[model samples]
Target chain A: MISSIGILTSWLLFLLLALVFITNNLLKINIYVRLIVFLNVCLFLLLEIGLFFDDFTVSYISNYSASTTPPLYKFASLWGALDGSILLWNLTLSLFMYFYLKNFKINTSNVDIKIYSSILFFFVGYTIFSSSPFAGCIEANEIGCNLSTLLPFQDLVSSQIGRGPNPLLQNHPLMAIHPPFLYIGYVGMSAPFVASVSRLVLKETSSEWVNVAQKLTFIPWLFLTIGISLGAVWSYEVLGWGGYWAWDPVENVSFIPWLLSTAFLHSAKVTKHNNSLLNWNYVLVGLMFLSTLFGTFITRSGVLISVHAFSNGTIGTYLLIGMLIFSLLFLYIGSINRRYFISSEKLKNKFGRSGFFIANNILLFSSAIVVFIGTIYPLFYETIFSRQITIGRNYFDVLVGPILLLLIFLMIFSIKLSIKNINLKKLYEDNIIFINSSLLISIIFLMLFNRSFNLVVTISISFILISLITLNIIKNFNKKGNSSYWAGQIAHLGLGVLAIGIILNFTQSFSQEIEINSFDNFIFSENNYQIYDIVQENLPEKTELKLPISNGKITKFTSLNIFNNSSQQAISSPAIFRNLIKDSYISIKSINNNTFKLIVRENFGISIIWIGLFITSTSFLPKLKLRK
Target chain B: MKSKKFSLILIIILIFLSFYKISNESRFEKWSKILLCPVCQGEVIYDSPSEYASDMKDILQEQIKTGYTDEQIYNFWVTRYGERIVTDNIARNFEIILIPIAIISIFIIIFLRKINAKK
Candidate 1:
């Protein structure tokens, strides 16, 4: 108990000093002070185990006792609930904060770094004060609840039997790695914000920070790519949403940051080359930070009525307020720095890459804003007008589609230009034959397909992917030092694959709602389902039903499970989902007998998405060599 | 000197054109983002892909090309679906709180920056 208390205490202290770390104008403390603070935070987390396991006659342990919960869950419980998850976010933020500080070159004493570090500190501190997971369930003791009740089944299992992790979390191998990877992407926006803060606070009238920001920018974008991909994979095989992206607010939340960061990544390059888009870079990074804040708010705040946003509370309000304050501060600073921007660049052309960047940012922000308002509109309506409103896929698809086509066109052409001016006449003279031939081929392919417009969209987008692949392949030319390029290519290709999947799945998916008793599979689309084969006997903690899905050509089955254990099952029916790129969604929603419901959707292009993700995931391993 | 003048003139023309196109596209995207999808109740008009949504988007595109302010476009939708159609239930209160909050926070930050500048 004492040991765990120590761990909790260290994080509390770390969280408290966060503001001092981020805002140098308030307190420009020594770098060592922040470092010591985080060191203590890490120590506290380590100490928590003792308090957790001790058979103490204490407040938290008596209710959430070590005896009732699984040890794995007990450990995982650090982020399993509201208070604990907040603590987890703070801990992660603290870890990143310390690491970021430690990584700085000792001699590089730029004054803006104070505010940069302070931002990280403030974020961590607010997270601790507002939402700490290391909060001992001391309040449980205030009511004299059973210690067993304190430690839910999973936590008890964590104490005794090492119950498999949350069956939903355990369903696919991707589940294990997805969330941590996402947190990296979500929090990694700090790097660019740090750079942007330098631009704002120190008035570093140089492009060097943009260069630094660019070099580091791809990292979070890449992680976010993987996270979104893995999330889709998780959903396809689990949520039984049949499709990967449900346009769910949570899914859109992830995509919004990805879009902003992507715009930032691209715009930063323009700034890197021509010293143009300095102002745009500020906007992009600020937007990226806001997206992260908004995503946290959406996921945490119950204001949004999405199944995910249903987890709303005072913590949500605190987070939303935190996000609003953070956004306003950054926005204000960015506006103030308007004078320092490389304003009125003389080299921009009306219909070139700069235009592309501008259009892309607008579209990206538009996408994020639409999502932001839609996600929160329900709560606002309820509070202001005493009316409840629900917004769904109808709200998103209309606006996002045409912009996607526009983006695809931009992607195809934007990369071929740079600062010293493209000798367009000379390049056109050189590549006219190539460009004309490609355009002709695309036209012919579309004409032949009869759905020429859709073909145009797909072909142009695919060409962009192909062009990027060819360019990178040629540019790197078997180079070992080009891991960044390799990562970019893999990620770009992943986007292409995802896009193709989206188009094909939308155009070609077949689904049927089926009622099944212990042994029947309903046939739909290009596949046959033989039921009864997927049901597996109860595991130690839960019961599972597997659906074997097979196209006559390929035999693959997805399994679904209903967690029956009283300790394991609670709030919502969380299921284990595996995306074999074939079929199988293991859901805990079914209660058993004739009443079980499963919507089996057979999709054709899902595998393209899987393959795309696999390629991207493979790229991550090769990067161990690039660690320096 | 003649060549420099020509190049500078060309650059200005190109930059203006780029800015023009960007501004135009951004307007359409901005207005589209705020519009509610008729088919998908909670989603934005931009991210939806249904038939009704695509038709509405086409109309929105026409409005943008023809030059409609965001408020005008919003009003058009509001007239069609009532005021609930224009602002999301969440953003309705959002504008009221968001404006004051943005103002206050901006003021505070500016004040701080100024104070620091003095010290």
Candidate 2:
């Protein structure tokens, strides 16, 4: 009954949205009508929460919310499946729309809200009619059938044993955080997008729209970065793989938008400063919005078989049509307004600040293009040759590596040169000490570690760039530069730090896989590890292996559990002995009666990545405050 | 001015040295990395520990021993397992190469046109 009401409310919200769209005036839309739409979304949210706890009649709840399922996982089941996930997407969009309407309530012609609402309406309508969570239970021969729909005798067995959420999702707490943050990041892009469209439609070249786009872009971009990082952490922790990023299609899709948005952010600043890269900015904003939709389509449409893709369906066609229509609309609008985006100034020097922004945009956009090709090339290949293909991380790493190094070079070089004047003499004079010291330090550091000669050169370059930036920041602080300058300096420092972390961790980290019998003491890398005991636990049936690593002053226990379910999956909950310099990680990969396979890894200086990310995120808070 | 020249030379030397090192890497290692793992997502057969990946790597090693060039070995895999074996077939499919080139070309064209419009 609640499911039926939720579907009904969605239709009502759609009607209200259409009425507002027809008039194209947000102010004319009745307050009661807007209030009712908000209420309708709230009602659906409440119903979902209620069904999660109580209503087994709802097939989704019955399938996911088992008696033994943890309370935390029960709440997470709201987005465990396609239908529930769409509902959550619609809810987030509506909530944002409601807030947008209220925020711009005084304005007579807020077409941004109308456009946003229409988008929300289309999604909500899609959710209700096509992928409704409230649909009646279908009779199936599966083990976990909807017990409420079955006969009394059938309910006796099936009702007691529910299927629960996907085992992989239920395994980790990060699953609860990763998907919501990603969805918010995805949905949050709608505002800047609509604002960009509004600028073109209103035929205005005011810096107002650019300012709006910049501020709105940060909110989503911030969440997207965190979401991506959380996903990497989740993969490292839960997948039993010692690696973080694999350049999977799902990972690439999320990264594509981040890259485009980074380009947009940089170009948007140029648009404000010199009224340049206006059309570039527009294309990026449009692509960002399209890419979010594209990402959603990839994950939900199941056109590609991935660990992350939803079950196969007809949604891919729908999404493809939507993307085409949106692309055509953008092209149509952009051609008409081509004259408006043209700037009066050309870049005077290639080494100037504006040139830096331009270079950054090119690099970022190029990377995004490469990633997009690598991701979609498989599908493209299948279409042309009627054969399956997969493009792995090597394809991307080979392209992106040189581009990133070039970007780092551009960053330091541009920072050294002034915008108006190109003084190579003064630039060299200012950076001479830093340059010498960085090269000296990097060479010595690499020699100390006795790393490969190739790594020495790259690390030396990275060190030099980082040192140059750090010295500049110190000089700026000594001169008492403003917080905004500091923000940029700190953020750039974070990037350098992150790059160093990635390089060192990638080059220096060592892993070994060993098979052991019962309890044994093993010595590796000047450390002793004891597999003290292996105990089998009840309540889901997991065999837990306790591994204690002792290093003179400290001892840490890492548990590896083999979940004996239908899948027969064994996962090791790795214990990380983290220090400022390095992390020693150990986990059990698999267990066969008396024999166990263990993976031990030492990650060198990877803590800086997390620290760098923290610093970078905090730098944006000041900008948010200034905008507010 | 002397320092600037010296630094420029140093950067050039560093880049050259790195390139020299990169060029010296074995073709067998390079080919092992180019092929995608059939069972695992985003994993190259060179890095994956699966039985299939190990077998594929052994074949690549055997092919290299027989004096088959990287292109020929890649072709052998393609014929054996279709286009799915190699992650990047830049030599086989010209369309894949066009993707980045076309995108970069479009950007350059637009940027150049925009700059020239003002001039």
Candidate 3:
């Protein structure tokens, strides 16, 4: 009877599946899919509302929620734990599945919709059977099951009172926005997977699916980009470090699918324009879905050690088996229908714009493969030689750095290159002015600063790219360009600015850890910083360090707040002085009365990276208008 | 023909410079990046904020000042801790290095073959 909630959830999914089958095989009405989707959404919302209300009879509510928690965190607790996260994933999938079904009903067959329905049902079923949030409690005591039973009860009396979400999850508001956006992006992959599978089932090789796949891929891709960026911002702010990206396995797993989908989006266009690379596009789409599942498996399996990994459980094995089955099914379908997907058409100019796109795909896909292998290599090594080894930032930097530079190089050339012809004369005439200006600017930049050759080259490349994109955008707008064209140009411009910001940050950011007592003075990066005051507050039960930093002309006062919690370790909030060119940040490592160790860092050009992200995400808004 | 030759020469120079720049980074920088932070999960010594990571950085800097080779410094860490103390050298990670190269090579071959196919 305790499992009744999961059982009831599964039964609802089953009924929805039955209705979909009936709609496909017998009724032929589109409204049934809509009805099922609406019902599923309502069920999920009701369960979450029950959680918000602290309905401790439900096992999940008792596990992640408490009566004393704030309303907002109580709502976020739905995704703070593993089981509820899966339910949220299922809900997001149904939402997207509903829209996808509505959009494609007129264009695609009922069988295609049924296949989509089946995919949604399988996920919902997986959640109910393997990792359901709706399991019920036996006793339903007032304080709920002592979920803190697993932890060493330092204060057993307080532990029995109440509990809250995971400390890291509750620390920041971004947790609410970040995980759901990521899940929505991950679950949105079902659309393209359904489209790709439906095409294979229908035995059609035309470019129809390419169009649908391309359009649908962008929706998830945009959400994924925002999710990744927000995740980076969260880490930068909350992880107590100034660095945003650490190239961790969890980060790499999420990134790999974005890379694959980017390749697929580019190649889908090639498949349409050149009538080539059809098989490549299909393979990329399949890989995108596979990467999502693989990422989910890694996060849930707990085979790897990561700060971002979810709680370990048997659900991982279920996800792994599901991944293997889907991968094998794709392989079988690919091998059997390989020839139909292949095309005999060739590129008009083998080394033209289309060629650049192909090169882009190669670079992206190869880097994705590198990241995937790097992520799994530790597991493989552990299984084989019984050794644990981690591939860190250096491995990724060594491989991906050059590939990214090459991508930028290709992007610069390809944008100006002709699509179907090798017009050397025209190309030269068009680019000679831009090339000369770029060189002049590079020379001036080198003269202005004493820097390494690599830094100079990178800056010059980014400058040239920015200038080129600006010129192109101006020309296009003068011609009364369409929104799609502007979107591409704006997005590319954002990448140019972002690359410059990243390069500058990597080369120039510096940090120093210093032990300080009260009234200690330290000079760093041409600034003198003095610990002016230390205040301890009682009501908030926090310590605040006041440090005044001065560079003769500009003086800034920054405070680092330290909060002590009885149940968990003390948490420190770093103080940051944000500037357009640089961010001066200080974090406290440990504090005792007047003496503490402080980490001071000067982060250069990070603001530009944030600005670039904003511009790039905004570029997609034009696409919505274009769709109309 | 002259412009083509000039562009080709420019590209070769660019390639050589980039290759040289990557290989010739300062020894202190390379050594600090090579070690793993003892207390942090999967973070390199240079990026982690742990006291152990700070101590490792001090050891690396001292060794570099004493004119120790990168290998000798790496051996110092490995001798004290296990081989897990340092970031896995891709140079020594045969399986890890081989699989990625093979995968990329195969994909490139397939990609080239597709592009070169006749209508």
Candidate 4:
């Protein structure tokens, strides 16, 4: 069978499970259905994996397999192709099914519970039946060196050589873990969203539901944030791109959900603060789930274009159907409850955390809306206008950057305002005095050595630092078990530091386009880059010359590129250079003379972003630890 | 909650306005020649430097600059790349195939419901 048939079978199996789940009142089928569904998922995953990993004996496998492909890469290669990647997607979903089936048991005879089961069924049915990883190109292969093909897979096999994976994917170690973590985080949050929907439509509202549900949502959000950050770091360092977040539609798909989830996190707080907003909270949580499915739809459905999309034609369409159902069904359900949701009278507290919470949701929604427009606008253009208007960094930079800046500004300023009016004079007198002193000390220390200085940035940071310190002191002055309170303060402080890093790093970045061999004179950003010496060398993996580079005597680094490799004497790397957290770009065009070659400009700045990300990543540690 | 909602709306409007202003000032930097070639898929021809994925960056940048209201640019590329413009190709047919199916199915359910209610 082609990939399509296998995936369709998998969908049928999930649908079978859904039927069993719905009829649980009539038939004792919980354990049996779980086992059957698990087996079905496993079967689909295997067949899909086999489509990539098995030999030419299997038509698709032989066509894509290669001799030089390593074992680890061979397995990872399962996700290397369009259909193969869908296989991985199916597997991630299946594993999620396993986890949820084990922990969460549905109480039978409830139609809402049936709806929940069917929701999952919709996801599975769409994934397997339509977007089958085993869809097409079931071509047989002949074993030889890829027949001297120009676009053949790689250096390994001859005419029959199967390409291992995208070279960029194979080059990095993080490739193995990043996609799985990201997908898990993406799918894992579905349960919380589902449970919230269950609680809402079932009209079983309680603080216990909120407490239980928030934990489920929060943990996944934490992992998803970390996963997204790690992915950014990977792209920055590995892709050799000086910058991360190029505003790809695929990246926006991942980001949109995160934005909605951020709203979910905050709106949950509103539910606790005001009993009236409980329905809004449920709707928001459901929307978060719908956003995740929408992301999957964007990826699987082929609505968005990017490197991250994987569509097997009809599978994608099935998913779109599911997404449409999800959106419309939930909207209808929520609208039916709209009358119940209306406030008898609106609470107008101009000064409180509730006000901030509301502001946070709208901005988060605003951010999501902007990204959604940017992401899908191209698809609309292509489909309706028959145009290929590509939305890129410029669009996102223009649209999203300011919105994010606004969010950050709110996040920072939110600290200053409180729900209840308090004695600000006493608080400032106690903490601001010391904070301002520290700020003065640090500002002086920085200005003397560094040429660039900003008083507003320095002062704002002082405010953040002081608020954090004061907040902590206030929260745990008597060693209270309320570390979660301190966790919020520290996390906000980390974001403030991140803002500082962004500003400082952006201010200091320098670049100049010059060839290493010919550039005797170097001038960039009021600083001169000097190349002292160049020596050709050979390595086990690659061959190139080492050029010693310096900016005055303060900086020393090596610049090089491979023109040959160990196995194939002529395998040359596109001139690239790197460090763990930072990258210094080098583009070698051609060696004109023995000593003269053309090269592009040098650009580097991952450290600032990643370090900022690291700070943001660690901010979660306190929160996770505080969770009981 | 009401006050907060108002503040949030106000903040969102301001943010949108700021972006609208920025969009007005920004210029599109198209690299269709370097980022995308009519012949190839998933390859950006610009050279990489300083450990910077310049080729990919150029490609991505070009994709982004596809213009906010790029009715003209998008149409031109669709003619150029055909359906191959996007390699994933999953979501496109969904608009054609599934929307109709979903609509048809929904109506059938509604019709069946009405009959049952009459009975």
Candidate 5:
């Protein structure tokens, strides 16, 4: 009964809010917004109450939460399944809308709010109609109740116990936070999208919206960078693959928005200066928003088979239709306001700072396109030819790799060109010494180490980028520079560091699967290790097999957890020994009588990737502060 | 002029140095990475921990021992499981490469044309 009431109340409230905003163009009523936000909060609290109380009467609670689950995991279970995640997504969107309305400037009209509220209403209605967590199930079964349409229920069987959260999700704590970060990043893109759409709808020609959009873009971009990196870290630590990025369809979708938003940031920066990329900024913002929707659709609809996709539902079609509606809306707005997109000034120099910014935008956008195509091509091929094909990491490595390298090279010179009155030739003249020294150092290092082709190229470019950044810091350390300038340099440095880490880890990492007898020693990466003991523990929910392997000085315990669930799934937790230089990862594949197979991997310079990601994402902090 | 010549020389040296191979990766390691595990959702045989993947690896090893070349092995998998099993069949889908190149080139050309019109 409470679930039904919650669903009806939220549904009616969203409908009423959308109607109010649509009817009253000048509606600045804070009370209405406050009431909606408060009620949304209450709804979330109600769900949490149900989860904590283990209310099997509520289908979502019974399906995803159990009494034996930990408190943190109980909290995280709200987003573990399809219905609850949509609710979470709606909550995040509402919060973003509240902040956006609160921070709206005076000159900005209420149309933006109307469009934004309508978006919220659409999502809320979609949730209510399609995948409402509050919807009651018809009959209880061993697994759970079958999802029924939105209707009032007499009463569910309260005697039924709840199934716990997915074992894979509960195994790692990172699962608790990763989705929220990605959702925040995904939902925040709507702000810039709304601002741009409203700008076009109002036919406002001033560049003031650029400032708003740029500020809006950065927060989401920062969160997205962190979100994607945290995801990489989670996969590396938990997936037992000894690899971070797999270029999966779902991963590519998330990255596409990040890439597009990055392009928007640069182009919007240029638009603020000279308005050359005004139309381009609008298109980029639209694409960024569209890509997020596409990502959500891909993840939820199960159109493409990805490890991260949720169960198949009708919600995918709704989202696809939503995408269609928004695309048409964007196109109509763009066509009517096409004249307003023309720039007042022309780009004079191809090698100037603005020019490089444009080039950067192109590269980023092109890479986004490449990833989008690579992700969707398989589906298209399957539909057309009735055959499945896999467009995997190698496709992306071949296509997007050079673009990233070019972006890094552009970073090396763009900073130098930012100085006043410095042409390309003049910038080159100033940095020639640093460049030559960097090249020499890379060549000598390559000779000493004797690395692969990919490593040689990455090391050379990374050295050049490092030299450029160091020189720029030495030259500008005492001088005052804008927050964006320093942020750009730090982000560039982070990119360089991340690139080097990725390449080195890829080329230098070694993995081997060996079957060894009990207490037998094995040599891996020139280190001798032997299994000292094996311990097995049985818990209420799972059985764990722990193996303590020692390298004469220290012992590390790696365990395989076998869950006593319907799936009987087993998850291996790798024991990773980390230092400043490399990480030694060991995991047990399987064990038989008197013997066990171990997958041991050595990843070099992997720590630098995390350091680089930290630096890169935090580089936006000063700029965000400036926004305040 | 001096910087341009110096950069040209550097590029030449770097290109020559890239061909110097040092890392030793076995043929099995190379082929396992591009072959998708039949049971796992997007995981290559090189990374998947499923029993099916392990069995596939054994079969792959047997093929190698039977003197099958890289192309022959890939062809065998493709024939058995269709094109989906081979993750990186660039030879078959050449248009995937061309489409991106064409899109990027179009963007560059349009950009340059716009700049030239302004000039």
Candidate 6:
């Protein structure tokens, strides 16, 4: 019965969205938007209710939730799978549209509503047709049927049991919150996309759209940063890999859009200030939105192998076709409206602030292109050469590394330069003290502690960046107002800190495999580690092995969980002991009759990365509040 | 003028320092990163905790101990498990390297031309 209600609500939402495009004149757009939002809320609530009640009659609940499942897992199971995540996606899109329309004055001729509603219409229609969570399942099948398969209501009634959530997802609490933040970040790009498209289509030449686009991009960019950071934290704490980012295809897809949105944010600032890079802003915003769609395509489609991808399906082909159609439509509109993209004022000085912004955009955009190609190259290579090849961390480190270095350089100098003036002499004089001090510190530090050439370069660059940004902040400390300037500087300082952490962690981290008997002590890297106890806990559906290890100062517990489900999967959760300078990470590789093999790694400067990410993400809060 | 000269001298010193190359990774660390875990999805042998990855690491260590060259060890893996086993193929492929360089250079040229055109 609840499954039927879900399907009906989705269909109602789809029809209401379609009415915005079909019957444009019959009802007000606000009425249609209201109906769509209401139906989306209803659909979302219906799924939540189904999961909460353990309604085995609904296939989604039966597949993901069991009677013994915790209430939190049951709630998170709504977005734990492919079909339900799309439902969450639709609900997020509707909420964004409802709130945006409430604040902005969108007119009848404004293609913003139409474009926005059409995106909603496409997702709602996709939920109904391609992958509906409301589909029923059969009980007798040994393995559960494909999730997207729609069965009769009579068949679902026969199934009274559920398989429970994906053991990997329910293993940690981070899984529940990570996907929501990421989805909000992904769906939030549609706002600027719709605004950019409508602005191009209507040929509006005012700078008002720039403000709207910047504000829209800034909020999503903050969420994307937080989401990606949380995902890294989850990967480190949960995956037992002793590392955060793996350059996996899914991670790259999400990061690709972020790179574009960040570039757009920078270029949009230039356009607002100097009325330049107008055309670039439009294209960047458009790409930012489309890349989100492409990200969804890569995640849902089984073409690329990713640790984070859902099960393979035909939904990928449909999403690709949809992406192609949208790209073509955007190209069509952009080409016909090319003349309006031309800015009245050209960049007059190569050494001015706008010049640095332009260079920053180039480097960022090129890095995005490099990542996008590296991600999809294997698919192309497989098709043509009939061989499978993996593009891993080495590929990105080589190609995108130099570009990032150049961007960091630009970030430091761009702050000191004026918008329209070219004054290298005065700039040098102003920053000479900072430059000398940073160079001196870098030289001394490298002489004392550097292990490799890369470490030396990274240490030197970070010192320069941090010192320069601090110099800026100190110079501007007593001056009132310009909170935006302070925010940007703080964000840059955070990036510097994050860069230092990443490089230090990468260079200095070492792991060793050691076999230790119970209650035995081992020595690694001059730190003595002793295993205190190994405790096994029996839960309703799983067995967990918790190992407590101490390094004479602190004890941390690392665990391995073996699920009692049909798949019988096992996941190991690493324990990290963090301090002001570094983190001591330990994970269980395997266990044999009271003997445990542990991978103990000393991760240097990891705490600094989290602190940096915190400072950077919160810097946007003041800017966001000022937007209001 | 003094600050400009100091900056130029500093740049030269930095450039000269960057050319001093040293090997930071051991043979085991390097080879473990280049080879993928046969059973895991896109994970290197060094990072994966699976039985197969551990076995691969053992074989690699044995090869290194037997006085095998890097090329000989890499070839042994390629023969055993095709070209897909190597995780650094994109870095080794010369044709793929040119594309990104060309794209970045083109962007730089366009940006420089736009700025120069104004003057």
Docking class of 5: acceptable
After superposition of all CA atoms, the RMSD between model 4 and the true structure is: 10.5
After superposing candidate 3, which stretches have Cα over 4 Å from the reference? A1-7, A22-29, A66-68, A106-108, A138-162, A422-425, A446-450, A478-482, A536-569, B1-32, B51-69
Q: Write the per-residue lDDT of candidate 5 for residues A142-260, one digit (tens) a residue.
A: 65565544765555554266777887787789989998888899999998888878877888878777788887888788889889999999898888878889999889999999999
Top of the candidates by TM-score: 5
DockQ of each: 0.03, 0.30, 0.33, 0.05, 0.48, 0.41
Model 3 Cα shift for residue A17 (angstroms): 2.6
TM-score winner, 1 or 6: 6
Per DockQ, the best of the predicted structures is 5
The TM-scores of all predictions, comma-separated, are: 0.69, 0.87, 0.88, 0.70, 0.95, 0.94
Q: Looking at the true structure's interface, with contacts defined as alpha carbon pairs within 8 Å between chains A and B, what fraction does model 5 recover?
A: 0.53
User: Which lDDT values do the candidates have, in the order given?
Assistant: 0.54, 0.68, 0.71, 0.52, 0.80, 0.79
Model 2 off-target regions past 4 Å? A23-37, A40-44, A102-108, A140-142, A145-160, A342-349, A413-418, A450-454, A472-486, A540-568, A579-582, A624-628, B1-37, B40-82, B86-98
The candidate 4 chain A region of ten consecutive residues with least summed lDDT is: A144-153
Which numbered prediction scores highest in lDDT against the true structure?
5
**Candidate 2, after superposition: displacement of residue A468 in Å?**
3.8
Model 4 — TM-score against the truth? 0.70
Over A1-628, each residue of candidate 4 has an lDDT whose tens digit, in order, gives 3333454466556767666565756344555456555665665556546634444333334434454555565566666655555555555655555555555533533443455556656655644544433333323335421222111122233234444345555555776667766676777677666565555566553533454456567656766777788777666545543445656666787888788777777767656655535555666677777777777777766655555665545656666677788777677766665544543124345336666666676667766776776677667767887856454444455455555555665664444455564345654455554444444444443442223323234334544464555566476635654444455555555555555555443333333335545447466445565665556776432355555555564444333444221221121222334333234544333344535332423343345456556665565665656656
Q: A318-394 in candidate 1: lDDT tens per residue?
A: 76776776777787787677676635244355356555565666566555666666556556766988754555454
Model 5: how far residue A76 lies from native, Å? 1.2
Clashing pairs in 6: none
Worst 10 residues of 2 chain A by lDDT: A149-158
Per-residue lDDT tens digits for candidate 6, residues A475-555, read: 764564455666677778888888878777877777778889989999987878889779999998678999998889888
Question: Considering only the true interface residues, what is the Cα RMSD of candidate 3 after superposition?
Answer: 5.1
